[model samples]
Target: MPRININLSHQIVKKFGLAEVDDFGTSPEFYFASSVNLPKNSAFANSMKSEVEKYSFRPTLHAPFMHLNLGSESKEIAETTRKELQWAIDTAAFLRADIIVVHPGYTALPEKKTIEHTGWLDNALPNLDFIAKYSEDKGIKLAFENIFDRDPFSLLLIKEAIGTSNIGFCFDTGHYNIFAPLDMQDWLEALDGHIYEFHVHDNDSTGDQHLPIGEGNIDFTSLQNYLVSKEISELPVVTFENKTLDFVKQSLSRIREWEFLKT
Candidate 1:
């Protein structure tokens, strides 16, 4: 059976009445915890490490993206993002997480100021190099996710420039619904062979609704068919990025009931 993971935030834990880290599912995707609780050599991080060992769970991480902007035009802002991401990388290493998810951090520039003129590559590439190397040294993979892009062009460019095996993609379906001007299949086609994970959720194509599967306009059948066509060596990690545990559970059940996925 394919492994299905849920992205755990404080809200989910509260709703589930889970008192300990081990109460998380066997495959846990840890979202960024409260920054106030995260210090250098954080006990919170240590407890997570211990829980992973105790339960023998395979873990993934969603790095902190609040106020992080790797492709910012401001030098200071970019530097701060780099530092915070490095810290996230360290935390992931401590937890022995296999993959750390990140946002691309590039915003659409003014019509005249293209990606080149805005220093998007200049700011993002070096950070990618450093993060990719750091993740490699720690035996973790960095998966850059799509957000706010009308097409896959920016991600494709970043992939081409970096060209590191340890660097991969985490396709977010809800983000695509909200932002991508092109068809979902186009994004999938462009990202084929690079996707290592997924943020699976539904949306109305006008907003990131994070609805249960089949409740929105997303063509999940096509998504399953696309996965079936891929010749990847391992099943990509499928994370239900939802508002609540109940919604995530509903999505999981719907995923299992998909005709193509059942095969």
Candidate 2:
């Protein structure tokens, strides 16, 4: 059965001061902001890690965003992205999280449209190779997310180019809504054997709005039923990736009540 999880963004939560992500009431620290840097064995990681372990909620991680990126066109930026991902992976391992979500890349080409798919492949393969190898050694699966990007094809192309078992996919549902109109099933099939995680959220027709589960137009019931049927063997980590904690928590409450019911 699918389980409720949070995407720890402690800074955002601290700003709002709303607790419990909504009334459905699961611990938000581990699910959302659990992987950020905290004092080593000093009260912080221990306290939050203990909170999650006590609850027995499965943990998943969203690596630092806006700060690091694996697919930066510049070498220095790319290295920073790689290091941040390594930190997130190491922290997830410490917390016993089975999965980590990462944005696969931005355009390796400054002019993505001018380049053919083959040329883009030439540029991204080495970076994917490094991340995939690092993930294998770390024993944590790495999932490249599909953001509504500036590229021409899709991140799926990169997934194919660096065809290694350690690398997988996390399809942000809002991304499809933002950039394309394909139904979720079609998106799932396109990802096929590669999908390992998900960022479940809703959005306005105009952009990646990150609205509550039902507040926007997505059909969560259908998506939930399909995921359940697949019995995804990897313990797929579903994150409520949104802008605000209260709103995200509220959306999670509805999801737990209707979609991921207690089994």
Candidate 3:
């Protein structure tokens, strides 16, 4: 069965406590979405590590993504991006996390016709190479997630250019429902072997609402069928990115009913 994880930030854990997470019977995917959430000192890091260890939970991490552009043309912006990502890698290593999720740093703009025209890959290559090697050395995998990408091609390009097993894709269902120009099946096929994890949430296709699975129109049954067809020996980590505990529990119950996940 795929390892189940729930997305929680430092603020969330501080507010609700890990006992609630323990009750849910799922590991956590710690989301450090901003610099404020990143641990500032060893004491803070050790505290979190101790709490997580107490529960015997193996964690994953979501790197800071706000206003971070790995492909930025500005030298300062590029340097800052790499620095923050390196911080995430170091934190993940300290926490003994299996992988850290990263944003691909692409957004749709009117001036650019395609990713190549935007030069995102070109500007991002050096930083991507650096981070990929750095994370690999720490025994951590980088799962580049889809944000404003219109299709799988941009991520595919990154994978091909980086050409490293330590780097893989994290398919976000809500992002795909809202931002992807192609269908879910197309994404699954294109990123077939490279999928390392999933940010599973649902939205109405009108917005990134992060609703429970059944409340939205995403065809999760198709996702299950794809996994079954592949006869995968190891399933990717499934992290619920819902907004609340109720939604996470709802998604958990819904996914547990899926035949492929039941095994």
Prediction 2 global C-alpha lDDT: 0.64
Specify the highest-TM-score model's number.
3
Q: Is candidate 1 or candidate 3 better by TM-score?
A: 3
Per-model TM-score on C-alpha atoms? 0.88, 0.78, 0.94
Give the CA lDDT, 0 to 100, for residue 241 in model 3: 95
Those runs of model 2 whose alpha carbons end farther than 4 Å from true positions after fitting are 12-42, 107-120, 149-153, 232-235, 256-263
Write the residue-wise lDDT of candidate 1 on 119-200 in tens digits: 7887787788888888888888888898877777677777777756788789999988887667878888898887889899
Residue 139 alpha-carbon offset, candidate 2, angstroms: 1.8
lDDT of each: 0.75, 0.64, 0.85
lDDT (Cα, 0-100) at 159 in candidate 3: 82
Tell me which of candidates 1 and 2 scores higher on lDDT: 1
Pairs of residues at least 3 apart in sequence or in different chains that clash in candidate 2: 6-31, 7-32, 8-32, 8-33, 21-249
Query: Which regions of candidate 3 deviate over 4 angstroms?
Result: 40-42, 109-113, 230-232
* lDDT digits (tens) for residues 1-263 of candidate 2: 55556666646544543235434454342333223445457565676566567666566777776744455567797777666666777777777777778765553334344224435446556666876777787787877787754332466666666656677887787776676555677777677666777788897768778887877877665567656656536345567777676777677677667544554
